[model samples]
Target: MIFSHEFSETSEYSAGTYTTPTDYFRYTLKVFEPGRSVAEPIMTIEEDYAFLMDSQWIAQLPEVREESVSAAPNELIVYFCDMFPFQRSVRDDSTRLLRDEIHNYIHNDLGPGMLEAFRIQSSDWGFIWYGDWTSSRPGADSERLSVALTKNGTWYHGRAPARGHSWISISVEGGVNAYYENLTDGLISAFYHELFHNLQRNMSLELGGNANIDGKEDAWQFFTEGMAVFASSIGMTHVQFSQTTKARAYLAEANKFVAGGGLLDGELNNSYKAMF
Candidate 1:
């Protein structure tokens, strides 16, 4: 069984308004609270009664868990759907680590960093699906989020719907080991790359970009993918030389491809290579 970890449900939320210093636009957003409690339940009936009766028992209990279940005021709620039962070990190990890494980066690191960088006072909220959207268990918001989902038979590692643009779908088809060469950093960078796409979409609306994103979809692809690629670079920078070396090599290869008339616009136009 998957042990309990901190997670926020989309349902239990407090509404708040976010406004930039420029007063560009006001957004009503939801701040999600963790659905599960962190407190360790007293499994034994005798222990439960003893804990309530004795103050010493409280002191003896372990410190509260450091993992946060609540989404920060300016963050998105992420739900993981493990689609491959055959990859259970992969999910339990590397995938779980990836989940925590993504969680900490988004909620603790990136959100506050964005607020400071943008002079935004209002919170922004959305959801991210970190596994197959189709295989999501009931109540994972899969039904309502039918707007933009990963294409059924398309070859992709990750995508956020360009239309509704609220959620991101990350494909874990071959497990982190096979897909990412067993590199956790590689997995983190990949996830962050897609996450930055969602961020770009949200920030676009916040700063008054066209709501009809598809109308100018071709024009936006360069900037959209560029920002995400840059963001992933930053995400990978913590490891300094290791992943950065590989990423630079990849970028160089892409540069060569672009020099040969490759482009980052539409799916038909070699956009995948450019974005990756």
Candidate 2:
């Protein structure tokens, strides 16, 4: 079963334990207004995310969930704002119609730009959910977050200041269940982007440098994006993924130039360049 917990402007932590890992998974709602709660959804997006914490998905995504504070701490805050489709007609003032309008605008207008916006918001979820208490920022990043308690561990997520650089993740703003469809292959991009950013925290890399392949931190971003875009059904066959070796893949190039490396990091790296 699913247990839902809601947090408010004055609310902080709950008072007890939850259910099992599979039993208790948490998700954050993107409220456009100032004061909103899950009970009062307002918006219908859950940020682009999902996790099993089963340990077997490691190779494909290779990462484990670590436990944080015992109670809710705005841990994994997810911030989302519905967009109005640029050239579509709202027809009326219904939420369903509004959501459709927003989706259309994303596809035709924002185009690739939406990728940057979504990534910025998504990484916040990763940081808040996994980062320690002392790692939180107050008024600076004023987005609200929520968490659900489970028997195994609490499901944490939320949003932070939306003004940061889009270094950690690839954000796709307009659609729900994006993974199941094909559009420049955005779904696959989101999937790999999620783990690459989340797992990068554990690896040593130059992530937020200038170029996409800077070093430690930046490497995974390159590795994943390159592979994802290349593998994307969008059919970016123009750039080769296998023959690309070049070794210039994000994680690989970064560690060699600076200092970094870890499990799955390398495969994610050189393997992509191997395509060129």
Candidate 3:
């Protein structure tokens, strides 16, 4: 629905790595077999068949369905909780997309500048991790995964949330890049955070970000968490923007932005007026 035309799905991982949908479909069809039949199923049967499918397989929903379940085999609904974009531990050394997939998103030509530069060198794997420290929650450890399906959009489907503890519902995430960038309490993981509430745990949880994060607990938390433009921006940091000095610098300039304000406005004109 987000695109004018539907893009094909990315494939599931196979053997040592992931494969695309076209690859898997080609593999499963065996069209080259000598005695294979290739007739398409009748439309009515096809539609009925698709309707009864588990959430994950309901690719495109047809606009119309026949009055009833004419060919359904059973009444049970398939659950796919383990399938959501789930959370997990991501170490620096692991074979994961976070570290490897960054090649897909090229930053500004001059580079992600000092406002919060991501400086991993090309020779150094070009990957950084959205790490986890929940090892003590063995149930929530990385050794296993849980999946489920729920009625969302048009179908019940598999979803994985970014990483966290086991008994806790996963914070849903997907895509090679999105998968690894999630998991932190930081801003870029906002998608992962939402997945945690809606699809994984299905419970509303309290969350803070650029607008609501507190400076007292983490001086950079407010700015890093507060001023970020995108979810991923929350993770950006300036090498020079130390929590200690930066806060004082901000307060020093806030007298003007704060003249009519209680907080550091930092708006260019307002900050200039307050500081000068």
Candidate 4:
């Protein structure tokens, strides 16, 4: 069962003026097993907005807008920009596919282990803020981006829940394609990588009050990003990486590394060299 609530409000941000007030819908999902008295409920909050540009480059462009949709009990909200090439429905389907893979991994493999290690609630609700638009900084191309905002810790732009909550954001502007023939393998990997950032933040909060690593920020980034890449690799395999052209390209690189005896050498490798 699903219960949804819509809310509309006007708010000002440093970026620009909201031509059309920001609005969002909160969906509460309840799942009950047959012949069981207990139910599992998850909440998904979605926010959509349109802004009048203040930047000179896109100032002439019409108001940019975006929306979000939930895949019912999936515990995630997939945000998509209207200006993007892919239609809303297409983006939704791809997001649902990714969400299903993530859900399975989290519940079946990572959930219990994480709960025990972090001592935090094992809820799976999260957000996937996507698109090409610049919602964080003005005049910058924020195409391929991923970030995690810890509640009450720091505000990195965009809407987030109140204190004590955390969320993830992903931008697919650089790699997203309108053609169904071009699969979203890169976007899928990026989504999983960003999702891992959310998981890292949650674990950090359980160990430390804030998500920041204090003096070890750089080292923390190194570890987190490497792990995120590793997680994405695993996720791609689960989603049948061979089916996507982009994934095949990634696998080719991996195979090259293995062929060079890198796998047995215990070498520290990362998805990106700069990550170290």
Candidate 5:
């Protein structure tokens, strides 16, 4: 069944707050807007998101359901929002396909290989923000976020800040087919990239490093983004994932901008470059 837990803004160890291999999972409405509860949704988006999550078929799939309880705390807890019309048919179909792809990737890649290589277990509990969180936010930026929760095979809607959580955010703001050949393919690539970020977080924590460079366009950004790019390159093919090429194109422009004496930090396009 789906479970809902409230965390105090000041308390770090509440009832539902969990400790994964990466860090503590604290629930919040938005990272920037702390203490905002789903009780007060931005629009009707939270309720719309709940309707979609309630009817999902993947949560019932025997194999996936089994994996849902896997020891790996790094497994993805994906949430979709701003789905244009927010209907059951569209949300169900999208969620079904998305879950299938995620299961395959984790079962084949992250669980057995990547996490194994790092001496960690399979499937860490982390949230992924898929689709647009804002309807009129303008531009496809701000889509890279990690949010939400689920329990006992039931999904619940919420946002967990990426800073201290093993969170992975993704977005296809314009349309499902806007970034890649299809939404599923684009999401897979994005998941791979973010999964690497989680690994980076865990490794850093193990090394006693608590530095976070998210949103900063500095040299350290390369270590995170570049490593993710490298991981995605070696882990999956981007034939159906067109955003890779798009990010590469932007990176080329970013290179020229820096070569022309533009500072890597504070510029906008560099954010896009850092995303992929």
Candidate 6:
């Protein structure tokens, strides 16, 4: 059996006419074991009260302008916009490079069988304008260039956003040069890393599991990041890997995991330490 709850409210007050009211709620879920005369609660789950609010106001703003390029039916819809002239140039080139690499990796490495299993019919992937990081920018950094998230993920919470089987965002701020000296391989590696994450999420969902949980929500950064790093390195040629420091570093870490027989270890909590 399954159960759920939802709440919503609307107000007719102008911006200053009224103050929003907070609604606190609590709920409990109990599982009972069937018995001849009585049923006893075997498991009881309780949640503390929470003030849930409609967050549509926090959504991503509509794109200033967008341009789409043609791709295979199952391939990504590449959107290039919301960038300054120089950033646009870098994004344009990076988009093309990432598109080709993703296609090749999916077809050659991951294979059509895995693709069919994941049920990824099509993906919408693009680069967005992220201004260069500053001390005042808080958590903004060049590392934000590659990110993949589901429809319900935080990245899609605010503003009008496009819908697709999956959405991958690459930041166009700071330029590719700022992150890596070798532009082509660096962009390719980043794209593949995020692309693998999309695949991981899709595969988990198809298998009747939640990626955020089954994929280790608590230690996600350790496992998924390690897997993505390994994937990014393996997707490219040794020659290309030799040219990119990030790729080389990933390979080194992956090698350590393999060499230490980490895969044979039964300890799940310490697995990430081996990869590191």
Best by lDDT: 6
Query: Residue-wise lDDT of candidate 5 within 141-202, one digit each (tens)?
Result: 12222332222122333332221123543443222323344443444444566556755654
Candidate 6 displacement at residue 87 in angstroms: 5.5
**Candidate 1: 10-residue stretch with minimal lDDT:** 52-61
On the 0 to 100 scale, the lDDT of residue 207 in model 3 is 25
Question: What shift in Å separates residue 96 of candidate 1 from its native position after superposition?
Answer: 13
Q: Per-residue lDDT for 52 in model 5?
A: 41
CA lDDT for candidate 6: 0.38
Across residues 1-276, which tens digit of lDDT does each residue of candidate 4 receive? 555544345445466555433333222345556676564434334555444211110111111112233211122223333222222124455433342244343334323332221221122223222231222222322321223221222234454422111234433332232212332444445455554555555445555446553225364544455555566566556453556544432353354343434322212454334433
lDDT of 1 by residue, 44-129 (tens): 22211111110000011111111133211222233332222112124455433342254354345433443332222112222322
Q: For candidate 2, write residues 177-228 as lDDT tens digits.
A: 1222222233233333333332333222223333333356444554544433
- How many clashing residue pairs appear in each of the predictions shown? 1, 44, 34, 0, 11, 5
User: Which ranges in model 1 have alpha carbons more than 4 Å from their true place?
Assistant: 1-76, 83-166, 175-183, 211-217, 238-253, 260-276
Alpha carbon lDDT of residue 252, candidate 3?
30
TM-score of each: 0.38, 0.26, 0.19, 0.35, 0.38, 0.36
**How well does candidate 2 score on lDDT at residue 12?**
32
In TM-score terms, which candidate is top? 5
lDDT of each candidate versus the true structure: 0.35, 0.31, 0.26, 0.36, 0.37, 0.38
C-alpha positional error of residue 239 in candidate 2 after TM-score superposition, expressed in Å: 20
Ranking by TM-score: 5, 1, 6, 4, 2, 3
Pairing residues by index, what is the TM-score of model 2? 0.26
lDDT of 2: 0.31
RMSD of each: 19.4, 18.8, 19.5, 21.8, 17.3, 19.9
Any residue pairs clashing in model 6, and if so which?
58-158, 59-158, 59-159, 60-158, 60-159
lDDT of 6 by residue, 1-276 (tens): 668644335344344332334444456787777773335688878997745332211112223212232111122222232111112134445533342254343234323322322232122233222222111112321112123211222233222222112234444333332335443334344456555665565445445665562244354555565666666555654633565444353654565444544333223445565534
Candidate 4 collision pairs:
none
